[model samples]
Target: MNIKGKTILITGGGSGIGLESAKQFLAEGANVIITGRNSAKLEAAKKLLPSLIIIKSDVENEEDAIALLDKVTSLGGIDILYNNAGVGSPALNLGIANDQILKNAVYEMNVNYFGVIRLNNLFINMLKSRKEAAIINTTSILSLVPALEEPTYAPTKTALSFYTRTLRKNLEILKSNVKVFELLPPVVATEMTANRNDKKITPEQLVKALVSGIKKDQFTIRVGDTKLLYVVSRFFPKLAFNLVNPKKIYASLK
Candidate 1:
């Protein structure tokens, strides 16, 4: 929970929430190492934050994940592994038969869910060895209520949300010191959501809330509209569904 003096590795840290996270964590006095698939983006991020340790790697690749672990281990290990990399395919109607539907679902699941598991499995032992360590998984508000517009993307987060919760309980039962934290963020103004006109929080605002939550040792940190959605979904499932998948979204799809 102590950000100061701890080293953290964040995936997909070239821009958006990940980059903002690197900035805030650095300001908090933590050593930050960032990884992304784009070499140019990594270089740009390094230029922005001269102290950041940038590595070019893709979360979906097994070889890349292994190499990343070796590289991080050589750098003296990390106290936190922040899984922030995620992807979504273009909006498509799942009611119609289309090959893209399955393809999109697989791609989202690979990066958003399995990728987190791969990295966590590789680093769990190292994290346990640390005096204090944590694993942060970024799920979405859609994980609580599915969005019709983001059919595949929403399901991926839902699966990850379940995995994260189970993983936390499993670690606790084993008496492990490694802390698992699930961050459920609402729509944020990022490259991924650039096309959306929906209201969004800035990356800075989201990361500020995240860091504050981590410092307070809050495992499930819900930000912005996510907090409200959680409460509503618990009591009013039908209304929560309507809030996420409005009538306009259905009309647009049609």
Candidate 2:
């Protein structure tokens, strides 16, 4: 599907991959509206790219998601919905248990899983109206290969990946105009991992892959270690499990 002249809405566009992807879409001549929970961050993103349309919002709340859909549709029916909004908790990966895990789990599921489900339903009608409608869901390499460092984040992403695959097949059976897409991104240099020292791909690199995938009408677009994870998860599940197994380094959180 051609991205030019399309109206796209991207969740969590205030920073990292979403921000960069919005930049690329804007460059391609698409009307881009970005939503984030923080007004300052959204404003900063707007300052970085004055061409971008910023909406202060969060995907965790049903009301906020509904309002966002209405606001963007008024400008134009969203030709593409990029469901990339996600967040995780510090306790999720550190072998933490009990109350901490429970508290964090709520946000993780709220943003990672429910976020996509809500957006898909909210924008389904408008997306169907478009000549070429697409929905890009963001997953992670960990979703395929689990890691102790971030367990909650990965499971939610894995669930999302699972949902996207089935959703794609279901849509094809129904012969719907809306396309389901997933991006399994590996370690990227973003605020999401500001403290990490791993040498990962830049935001620009990921954005390029995203645009290319969208142009070619691909369903799953993965890059960097995620590509490796995809291959490993398919070809060598045993070895992949051993590589980043959570049980190994999980020092129980007191």
Residue 134, candidate 1: alpha-carbon lDDT = 99
Q: Across residues 1-254, which tens digit of lDDT does each residue of candidate 1 receive? A: 89999999999999999999999999999999999999999999999999999999999999999999999999999999999999998888888899999999999999999999999999999999999999999999999998888999999999999999999999999999999999999999999999998999999999999999999999999999999999999999999999998788887776
Candidate 1 C-alpha error for residue 143, in Å: 0.4
- CA lDDT of each candidate? 0.96, 0.85
The C-alpha stretches of model 1 lying farther than 4 A from their native spots are none
Off by over 4 Å in 2: 91-97, 245-254
lDDT of 2 by residue, 1-254 (tens): 79999988999999899999999999999989999998998999999999888888889999998888888867766799999888977745344346777767778998999989998988888888877898899988888887666767778988998999998998899899888888888788998788766668998999899899989998899888777767888999988887655454555433
- Please report the TM-score between candidate 1 and the true structure: 0.99
